[model samples]
Target: MLKTLSAYIGEYKKVSIKTPIYIIVEVLMEILIPFVTASIIDKGIQAGDMSKVLMYGGLMLVLAFISLFAGIQAGKYSALASTGFACNLREGIYSNIQNFAFSNIDKYSTAGLITRMTTDVTNVQNAYQMILRIAVRAPLMMICSMVMCFIINPTLSFIFLGALILLGFVLFFIIYKVTPIFTEGFAKYDDLNASVQENVTGIRVVKAFVREDHENKKFSKAAGNLYKIFVKAESWLAFNNPIMMFVIYGSIIALSWFAAHFITDGTMTTGNLTSMFCYVMSMMMSLMMLSMIFVMVSMSVASARRIAEVLNEKADITNPENPVMEVPDGRIDFNHVNFTYKKDSDKDALEDIDIHINAGETIGIIGGTGCGKSSFVNLISRLYDVKDGSVCVGGIDVRDYDLETLRNEVSVVLQKNVLFSGTILDNLRWGDENASEEDCIEACRQACADEFIERMPDKYNTWIEQGGSNVSGGQRQRLCIARALLKHPKVLILDDSTSAVDTATDAKIKKAFATKIPGTTKIIVSQRISSIQDADRILVLENGCVSGFDTHENLVENNKVYREIYEVQTQGGGDFDEAGE
Candidate 1:
């Protein structure tokens, strides 16, 4: 836990030498508090010296004021440190997630990632604050108080030591038992977050199916279990403070009885006895700080371990040292590419398939569900590594290019369209951060999104809610297309991205692609026959294997699956404009 804490401290630029200075002043002020009280009783009251009483009491007040000032300063430092650390932590985690390969993200569900970012990060931040504040100061106070007590009366202080040791045993037992419970709590929190996120995102379907009551019951079960865990943990922690308070008071009573004999025997003066009482009070206050710190530190340790696991993950997709920065010429070659998602699996997602795409050509991939249509395109973008062969973009292996340069050159509009929280223009600018206003408008025009966008109250400046919640499905698809269009990439991938748009809109978008993007190499992956019917070349896939590759006319004539799909889709009254010059 301390190691994790040390690592977190290193991340924050705000953590400075001044933090420890405040902590030292705070502890010193705490140590002097009882000594001043002992002096008030011993020197002032016993000798009837009112002036001395005022002098020592006035010094105590000064120390108390300084302690208050130090506490506020310490709080400022702690707040600044925790805030800066949390921001750094969030940014670092986001950067890691941003660069993670598509296959890596696929390994974890979207809902799980959301929980990690929000709930998991919050836990880490809480731990950070505790480590900087209570964790540092509490132990120091306990040690200082004990040393002061030892100077006052070693015999009475011996009694204080035994009680503290007994208290430590109690604390250890509580922490050991509760740590596992905290781990379980965080797990259940993940499940709870996943369920809530899924339900809210799919609320339309849930309402259509009338699953509100069912979902409510399910949520109640999760929330109720969380409540039970929280209550159990809180109750366990709550019991410790009262028990510690009782122990401290009991020790004071026992010490007073032991000291009575010495006072009467004249072995100890009344002033000496007074100082011992002051020591007893100091011990109690120190124990109180110790108990709270122990509880918090235990909770923090569990959270730190969870955060460490995320930070320590190694990247599976990273650039090679001395990598080639090749400019893509739009000439792509796939040489016997055999790929599989599994590490030790014999089955390949794509078998020894070989193909070549020249510059300024259109390619269409037609396949059944799970026939590796997305996977095949994903490899060209280096979203996954191929085992058997190489994917060359611009006549050089994709891995030979820097990841940022390669990715910038290849734009992909995935099946699941994502729009961030911003204005329409802002989201479109994601493709080209420095895109001009005219650039966005032109991209929108080409993508067939300008018609509705111009209808929006703010047009290009219209606010798009997170995940494009405010936009229609087809609108989001067009916006995604516009985003890709803004980049002017060498290769553009439309992976079943036109599914949301109607056939007429799809045709318009397709025509715009042919005219507006003159030299861009295009790969269109679709299950619909109409979407890819006009492609210069079409590849048919069956059960993860490329059944055939040719023109749409040739594929329909030869491949039975392609023929059946065409016959069904066209017969369903969907007019396909497959006219050629």
Candidate 2:
């Protein structure tokens, strides 16, 4: 985990190195001040020499200023390195997520990823800053102060050694006890984040159902779990400060007592006793800082592990070594395909699907809720690879083509319509970045979206809220269709995209597809029979298998599943749901 995380410190290595160099310089200056003070007291004041006093005092002032400057430089470099490391980590995780196949994404939750990118990264950054500055300063300061004290009065210095050994064991015990609690606490952070995310995103539904109290209770439970774990860890950590202060004060008293008798016996001078006190203070404070560093490190270990998980995750889908860059035409072929969202699952999402679609042909797909309508189309763009057999686009296996090239040629407006926060023109431009104002309007017209867009106050220039929350469901669907149409893809797959629009408007969009873009292969997945009855061919799927694939007239007369659906819709017996939902 350390090796993986340290790799992100890319360009910041120079700054990271500089921070510790400055810290070491600061420690050296700090260690010299006490020695200079001891000289001023014994050789100058006690011996009645004003010149020695002035010289040593001036030297102390110079060291003080140099130490202050080094400290400032250390702080500056530490900040730059830590914040830069955090930015690089977030970027790395997001870039990796963008490359994950659908199956890879299923391994992690949305809230879990968000927590790793934000809270976990922040923890790691704080720990890194502490490591760069305090981690270097504390140990060096302690060792240098110890050496100084022993040179002056070795007998009194042993008190500091004894205190350090006792404190070391105490600190080690505290860290070991608290680390596991903090690890469990960080895991609970994901649950807390997930609760917040679900509540905020579906706030309207929560309010509509009058489940505010229920949601409150749910959030409280997650928050309460996190609070309990932290409280338990902190209760154990509370011993650190008190134990450190005990050893610090006890060492000072012991050293003072020993030094007083040594001075009376003429074994230690008054100046030596004073310097011993200074060394004692520096050594104890250094130990205190070391304890704090250990605490920060313990808290960050869990977060560091979480971040490493994302950084180390390999992409499950990658383009072939020698890939086809161009998609020649719209023809699609699924030859005996088998796919399962889970590799070891008993049932496949799509099973033995052998279907062939010709170029520019309008094919209609009708299936129940779980009949794999979306799954079947997803394979065409290689969003998820098939477990068995091959999916071919433009006469080449999808895996053999450049991923970007294949997806660009086969545009799919999924069952859930999505629009980003942007102007209508901006959202449409996602389909074609270089498309002009005229081109956007033309795509909107083809999708039958221009009618309402013109009615809006700002038309194409109107700003859309995130997720298109400002627009009605039908309007959002139409805008998504316009975005896909702008792609001018060879094959256009609409997975229940028109379900939100009225039947009449849905019919008009289909008509526009036939008249405006006849050479594009259109595949429509719908619950309504009328939306697809006019297609060149219709595919009826049931229980993950194709029940029938023929023209509408032949399916109604021969296929049982297709005939029942046609009968139900024609006799106004409500919509046809093959899943029987």
Candidate 3:
């Protein structure tokens, strides 16, 4: 985990190094001040020499200023390094997420990834800053103060040693008790974030259903779970302050009592006892800082592991080393394919799917819910790999081609269309970044989207709200269709993309596809028989198996599932799922 996270430190390595160096210098300067005070008390003030006192006092002020300057430099560098490290971490995670295959993405929830990138990263960032500054400074200060105390009088230093042993045990116990709680708390954070995301994204549905009170209750439960975990963890940490104070005060009292007796016996001077007091305070403060560092590190350890999980996750699918550069044509062959969304699943999502599609052919897919209509088309574009057998494009295996080359040649406009926040032209340009205005207008015309675009005051330049919320569902689907058309892909898969549009508009879009892009292989997945009756051939799926693959006329006469669906939709006005049942 450390190795994976450290790789993203990238450009900030210099600043990270400088922070600790400055901290070391600051600690050295602070360590000398008490040594100088001892000289002032013994060699100058007691001997009645004003010059020595002035000299030592002036030197102490110089050390104090140097320490202040070094501390400020350490603070500046640590801040820069930690924030830069955090920026790099977020970028790295997002970039990695972009490369994840569909299967890789299924391993993590949207809310879980967001929490790792946000709250978890912030925790690690803070911990890193503390490590660079306080973590370095505290131990060094404690050790140096201990060395000075031992050098002054070895017998007196044993008091501090006993105190150290007791405090270390208490701190260790606190950290051990709290670490697992913090880990569990971060997991609760994912649940809380998931609740908020679901509520916000589907707030319209919630309000439509009059479920505002239910949503409130759901959010409160998630929030309450997180609150309880943190409260439990903090209750354990509350022992820290009281334990620290007890050790510090007990050590101080023991030192004062022993030193008073020693001074009366003339074995230890007043000057040495005063310096011992200063060193004891310094050592105690350093222990306090160390305890705080332990708590922070314990929390960050969990966050670090979460971050490393993302950074280290290799994509399940990657381009071959010597990959095929180009797709020859739209022809696709699924040779006895078997697939499942999960590796350990007992059943396949698509089972023994053997189908062949010729270039420039229009194929239609019809199925009930969970019948693998989308899953079948997804394999055509290699959005997923087949568990058994091979999916070939243009007579070549899909895995043998460059991922970008294959995906670019096969554009998929999914059932749930999404539009980013941008102008209409900007959104369309995603299909072809360098496409000209004339090109966009042409694609929109073919998708029957130009009608709406022309009706709008700003036309192609109109700003679209995020997720295209400002537009009607039909309008959003048309825009998405237009966007996909701009790709000019060899194969285009529309997975129930026209469901939102009216029957007349849907028919027009299909007609436009038939006329405008005749050479492109179009695979349409729909529940409506009207959408697919005119296709060259239709595929009927039952569960994950193909029930029939033939033209509309042949399927109506021969295939039971297809015949029932056609009969119900044409006469009874029922959906495919009802007919299948």
Candidate 4:
């Protein structure tokens, strides 16, 4: 809890001093108002002097104005402090996620990361905003109210203290029970999010299989479990409020009655008795506010820990401080590389692999699904460090280079390409932020995307729906290629990037790359033999090992698996060429 508080407060070192001063002024006003009210009741009202009455009454009104003005000023700063704090923390988390290696991203599911970004950040923001207003003020009002009560009448103050202790215990019980429930609820929320996202994204597959009912039931089960957890947490949270109101009201009633008896006994004046009632009311209200703070604090604390879990994660991959950057010309090498998914396990993803490639050469990786072709490409880019041996770019180990330089030298367009919500030009500029209109169009042309994009009314300025859902799978892949092409990296990887497009379109796109992006090294990972048949070399992977590596013609001659794959792809060797037009 203290760590969470420190994390939030640390965001605004600049306004720290000024914020507390404003709080002090506000608290002081709160303390003074009750005292002034008692004096008006006892002295001014009893005397019935219009001038004297008007004087203290006007003074009370002036104090009210002063308090209101101070509250407004404090509110403005509190908003500034909280807004700036949330913004910085959110940006820091986003930056950290962006830098996280592939291993780290795979460890946390997409839904889990989205939850942290949206719901978790929102929780922290609410807690931060609340701390300045209720967190600080509640304690001040509680303390000062207690102190004033004792000064007015010590006997009644004891009752107030006892009631507070009871209320505090109740709130504690509320937190102790509800905290676990909320944690479970948020976890369920993640499951629900994952189910919904998967169903929506894979809606075509689900509908094709006629599994809408199955998917709905799957979603319903998750949502139902979440509903139970949400109910349990909210139930405990709800139980506290009414109990708090009853206890506080009961305390106030007892205190007021006790003060009345004192007034009749002439030990306390009527105004003093009235003031005690007023203080009791003020104190109870503050205590109620305090109860709410603890409840939300408990809930948000759970969320903060979840968010901090991601923020505090140290990725499995990071650059060494004085590391050498990989060569930009893409002379890639893997010297007896043995790699594993687990750090402390004997399960190898790839073992006893040795390979090298010259700059500007095209390498084709052909394998069955789960043959570690994807893993091999991931390693080249230093997404995950090889466990047992070194992966070198230009003879220097990948770990030696700074992440930014390594990434800039190698570009990858994944099989599942995502386009962010923006204009076509904006999406392309992701590869090269300062790329011009002409550069974008040229890239689009090379990727076979310019024709369809130009037909849109807005052309380059046409909007891309999130995940590029508005466009066909082929179009999304093309745009992603254009985006990657715009970068002009030394090593370009097409990781089954044209799987969505027909063979003819894929061939034309590759031809464009050969013509326009000359001297750029290419790594094509594809299941379709024809897709990579023209490469300078092809690698056949079997059970995480590189079983064969050679030219397409030679692989067909020498490698049985490669030949078989080619046979399976072509069947009768039908032509993919479009009819002359």
Index of the highest-lDDT prediction:
3
RMSD for each model, in Å, please? Answer: 3.5, 1.4, 1.6, 3.8
lDDT of 1 by residue, 1-581 (tens): 34543565564545635566788898889678777877787789888999989999999999999988988888888788877777766666677778777667766666656655677667766666766776667677777877877776677788888888888888888888777787777667777887798899899899999999999999999899988987888878877978788887888788789889877887766766666676666667766766776666666566666556556655678998877776557777989999998778878999977988888788898877778888889998898999888999989998888898888888999988999999998999999999999999999999999999989989999999999999999999999999998888899999888887899999998899899886999899877788888988988876677788899999889988788778877787542222210
Error of 3 at 530 (Å): 0.6
Number of backbone-clashing residue pairs for each candidate, in the order shown: 0, 0, 0, 0
- Candidate 4 C-alpha error for residue 417, in Å: 2.1
Across residues 163-247, which tens digit of lDDT does each residue of candidate 2 receive? 9999999999999999999899999999999999999999999999999999999999999999999999999989999999999
- Candidate 2: C-alpha lDDT: 0.92
Q: State the number of backbone clashes in model 3.
A: 0
lDDT string, candidate 4, 1-581, tens digits: 34643565564865644565677777778677778777777778887766766877888888778778878877888788877777766776788898788878878888988887778777777777677787877788888888988999898899989888988888889889998887777777789899999999899899999999999999999999989988888888888878877877888789777877887889998877777777787788888888878877777887788877877888778879897654757789999999988787767889888999888888888787777888889888888889878888866788899988887888898877999999999999999999999999999999999979989999999999988889998999999999998988888998888887888988999899788877888999887778898999998899899889999999988998888777765885642222110
Indicate the worst ten consecutive residues by lDDT in candidate 4: 572-581
For model 3, the stretches where C-alpha displacement exceeds 4 angstroms are 578-581
> Candidate 2: deviation at residue 496, Å?
1.0
